[model samples]
Target: MSSTKKVKDSHTIMTQLIMPNDTNHLGNLMGGVMMRWMDIVCALSAMRHCNTPVVTAAVDHISFQQPIDLGSMITLEGFVTRTFRTSLEVFVEVYSEDLKGTKTKCNDAFFTFVSLDEDTKRPSKAPGIIPESKREKELFEGALRRRDLRLIMAGRMDPKSADHLKKIFS
Candidate 1:
């Protein structure tokens, strides 16, 4: 790992064509299929940031804003939003592209992954993310709030202790 790295350093993008096998009977891409793609892209971003193998710890706040039809092109972009010890939070955005038209955001998700050491198979330190653009900085800050929410939801943290979340919900 280097001494410093930017969020752009770990950016990852993947594109897939929705096919019959990836869709439901309604001719729309299945939620599970989209989730799988999200996981893969996010994990790759985390790994790129840490320079090590990573494992998905949690996925939070997956929002499906639009339906992707079969035969449509789907693009998934991911980047590191923040880091916590051995864990890194990855933000992913999915876009649906039309044949003779533009691309629209169809889904967004946040994923957490823990870096792993190859030989020791233990949690390893991950590189810190240096947010560059305004959007990246905003997402970087939001990741901490989302992490607290995930911890509270998983019974690992108390609701009252999550100040960021309390500010919003309370």
Candidate 2:
């Protein structure tokens, strides 16, 4: 919860070329397709951080604030927010860029990934924090917030909704 404990320097930036096949009847990239790309971008960051294969544990939240048209350039940025014994929380931002170099934020989401020991096919510990900059700290702190939000959304903090929460959260 403290700012000093957060790490913020780590980041991953990627650009994707949208194709006709990724579009819907409306000529815009499908939301599902974008989400899949987001997952890949986030996973790449997690793997680079841990130096191991990672599997998606959960996606905390996804908001499609803007539509991305086919043939537009898609930019994705991802970074580590936090790490547990075997899991890492990553935040991803999606943007659509135009030929004139202007960019629009399309979506932002938090995803949790668990590092896996490929040989054992089981959860494994991630690398230790070596944050060297203020950005890393901010990212770590943000990840903490995302984790809390996920718990709250799952109804873990609501007593009255406990039953409904368990069925879904579990």
- Top lDDT hit: 1
Residue lDDT tens for model 1, 41-107:
9999988899888999998977678988998999999999989888889999999999986899997
Give lDDT tens digits, candidate 2, residues 1-170: 11222234447888988899999899998988988988998998888777778999889768778778878999999888778678788889998998888999988888999889979979988765655567767666566556656657766455553443344466
**Which one wins on TM-score?**
1
List lDDT for all candidates, in order: 0.89, 0.77
Q: Can you tell me which runs of candidate 2 are displaced by over 4 Å?
A: 1-10, 132-135, 151-170
Give candidate 2's root-mean-square deviation (CA, Å).
Answer: 6.2
**Which residue segments of model 1 deviate by more than 4 Å?**
167-170
Q: How well does candidate 2 score on lDDT at residue 37? A: 87
lDDT of 1 at 130: 90
